[model samples]
Target: MLPVFRRRPRYSIGSKLTLIIGAVFGLYLLSVTVIGYVMYSQYRGFSTLASSHFDRAMTAAELTRDAETIAAEVFEMLVSSERSINAGNRRAENLASIYQATRQRLDAVDASDVVDDQTRAELDRWQQPFFSSLERLDTRLAAEQSLQAAHLNRIDELFLLLQQLPPVATTASLPAADQRFVGHALAALSYAAAALSAERPGQIARLHGACQQQLQQLAALSLVSKDFIELRKRLNRTLPSIFTSRRPLLQHGRATLATARQTRVLAQKLTSTTFNYHLQLKAAAQQAITVHQRMIRRSLFGLLLASLALITITVGAVVYIRRAIVLRINRLSAAMHAHQQGHDGPIPCEGHDEISLMGSTFAVFVEARRQAEQQLEQANLHLQQMNAELHRLSEIDELTRIANRRRFDQHMASVWRRALREQSPLGLIMADIDFFKRFNDEYGHQAGDECLYRVAQALAGELHREGDMVARYGGEEFILLLPGLSLAQTEKLARRLLRAVRSLQIPNDQAEGHMVTISLGGASVVPTTHDRIESLVSRADQALYAAKSRGRNRFCSAVADDQNVMVGGTT
Candidate 1:
């Protein structure tokens, strides 16, 4: 021999499978740990970037809105009239408060780490000028408001003097010429008052000239009253002061306009700065997304590689298992299935593996089970025949061979439900031998049983409809279920049944006509959820009593009333 080499030790399928599965599980665990770590890191980074930038951007937007609103309010103050000045000032104070709150919010945002030093500096630079412009605008607005108030006061004084002159013109003590001069003065005063109200400078000046001419003419009249002279002196003092107050109100309006322009420019600059800051945030967010995308792609690439390796390993293991073990197991399974279905083919039992041992054991088990199954099937067949006979005997009376009380109850329930669903009439008949107890007493129990069987057969044979059924309710009593039969139809069928029983002519010495007969009490009703099946049975029993009370061998029908069953009619 050149060189004798020892054979490699053999391993069982379980050991080899465990080793392959363990290796696969280890690789899977390593891949999952690496992927999970990379994904978690990327998620944390993205979450931080998104939250910080989104919050800062929202704060910047709020600041921009407040700034524009403040600028609009300033312009509104400048153009407002004296009547609205106080209201505008109140609104201005509220806007200033809002602007301050917005600034505080911006400051809070700037304090966060999201804001860079350059952005904070730029924002601070814009905020200072914006605050100063708002302050200057507020000051000019206050000055304009004060001038308006003073001008209104002077106008009020002029109106007071004009009112006093009206009473003087109405005085009867004055001469006619003096009265005419007083009227002319009152007319000029009215014109002046209108001019002041209109806020027209030229109209006020023209009215002042007309008033001066009227007062000078009245002074030339020596007959003027002492009161008139005093009133004229007061008018002369108040009118010129009203004219002077108008100039300052105009100057304040011009100053307020200049301040509004400066405030608007500052607000624009602040808006621009906030917009730029927002753009920066958007760019930073985009950059973060790009970087995270790259990370995600790398993670996905690693996952794909891991998945491919797992797939390759799994496939190789599956091919090995299929060839080594699964094919044999499948053939054994198929053979077992075929044996169960009555084929006696052999099971696959090859190799020294566990499956081969299992297959050999299974072949013996299959034969034993098949023999047992055949014996069990014969026993099942005999048991099924006995069950069918028991079921039949349970529902049918032994002597009469018709349905018994149990079957009657089940049929009543089934028929009632059908009638209720279809909204159809269900007719029930409670039929008895005309004198059943007397008949049984006169004859023996054997003859009584024979009579009951004959009567049951007669009733069942008389029912023509497939849905109709007759059952022996108890000793010497039978019930009929006629679905879709009205009271009239039920009575007609009951009469036919009575005749059919009498035609049998089974002798009963105690019965009517010395022959067998039946008295039928029948009731028909449209079934309703509110009504009970027992109610129908009771109504039929009542009608049966009525038929027997009237005469033997008759059929009586009953209808339902609000409180009780009323005997409808008899046939």
Candidate 2:
């Protein structure tokens, strides 16, 4: 049986980052995102609930005011015969306007946003009776006005009949004294007509007594002339109807007044309920605020734990990967350098992790066959090729054709240290494509990649200065470094980059404005001992997140109004 040697699996840089750093960071990010989303949803719910409660309160108040005004109008109509016709019509117009306005406001209010279905149903239950009462009140007022018109017109007709009725006598001739008495009675009726027309209830009541006195005097003529008997009989016939017409007016008045009272009562009840609902929502809002605050504290605790875990995982992964790849590569380089100098030392080919390390060991085996002189030259060539491969892998993003995450990490660290040593500000910008994941889904991965390539080129081209650098940080995110730049300069550059990408007019159906756009978060800082390079990156990240939150296609700074942090916009 032949002995078998199992080849060890060598993990690539990307795979290692994924298994350890990526996994930890992804968990932290997901947790933070979920917590933020929950908080935002809670805030939205609170705000909407508060707004609905306020709107309902205002509407209730308006309804109450309208109901009161309508009731006042009903009261005014009771004295309608006393006021000018235009005045009465104006009141009617006002009542209608208020009622319509209140109804519109009520109709626009949707209580379902804050309250439960059961509460909404209860509100609907209350609304029906209240509005129905208002409608009934409106109807009763119309009936009352009609009855008033009928009553007044009946009095006018009776007065007219009194004036037209001719004297009745056996000789077909009436005495002047009888005629004078009839003329006096007709004059008193004319006065009653004048009072009724003026709508002066007090004058109408006073004229009632005068008109009665005149009728009494005319009654005396019954004994004097046969015409007086017919006039008196005809007058008697109308007096009953004129008196009876008051019954309908009184009935309609009572109905209207009763309905107005009912409307007012219902309106008051509805208003009280609205106030109670507002109070309830206010109390609930307070409770929600407390709950939100607790959640914020709890989320903060969770974040701290996640951050610690992320740091631990990151440090461990960095140590292991650096030791595995970098240590072996360094040792191989030393070996090659030693062989070239004709100084042969111990070249320990210990690890299975590095294929390059394995290849170096194989080259040593052929040293005797090819002769050490020739092998040294070949080893130098191979080492140079290996270094070039490692540099390429370390710096370039495979997909975006730009500087990768490794370059960003290395560059940011270097710049931060340089800033710390020189005491100059370092500007960092973190940018994200708005709705990029949706864009990717709509356009397909091929188009998305092409879009990224184009966007990266545009972004890279924007950095004309030698001190400026652009790198593909991650999915749909890019980072730029501008060393020795102030916040204003960084903000200006960020907006310029934003415009540059947006100017491409890359068709992104999923994004707002129906085109591809980028949101940038910018931060410039003079390094301090207390903070790490990640602090500046975190600032930029937060600003980027803020830009996205504000509807995207803009720029934001970590410090909202701090003199050291300037924000810009567009695109």
Best by lDDT: 1
Tens digits of per-residue lDDT for model 1 on 216-321?
7756766546777786677667655655566556556766777777877777777777677767766766776788788889888888998899889988988988
- Please state every model's RMSD to the true fold in angstroms: 30.7, 45.7
**TM-score, one value per model:** 0.49, 0.34
Candidate 2, 10-90: lDDT as tens digits: 765457656876676787787788678867866776675457655655665565566556556645655454332225445
- Cα error, candidate 1, residue 298 (Å): 5.6
Clashes of each: 0, 3
Off by more than 4 A, model 1: 1-39, 82-84, 87-126, 155-187, 194-211, 214-233, 293-330, 337-343, 350-352, 360-571
For residue 256, give model 1's deviation from the true position in Å: 2.0
User: What lDDT does each candidate get?
Assistant: 0.76, 0.70
Clashing pairs in 1: none
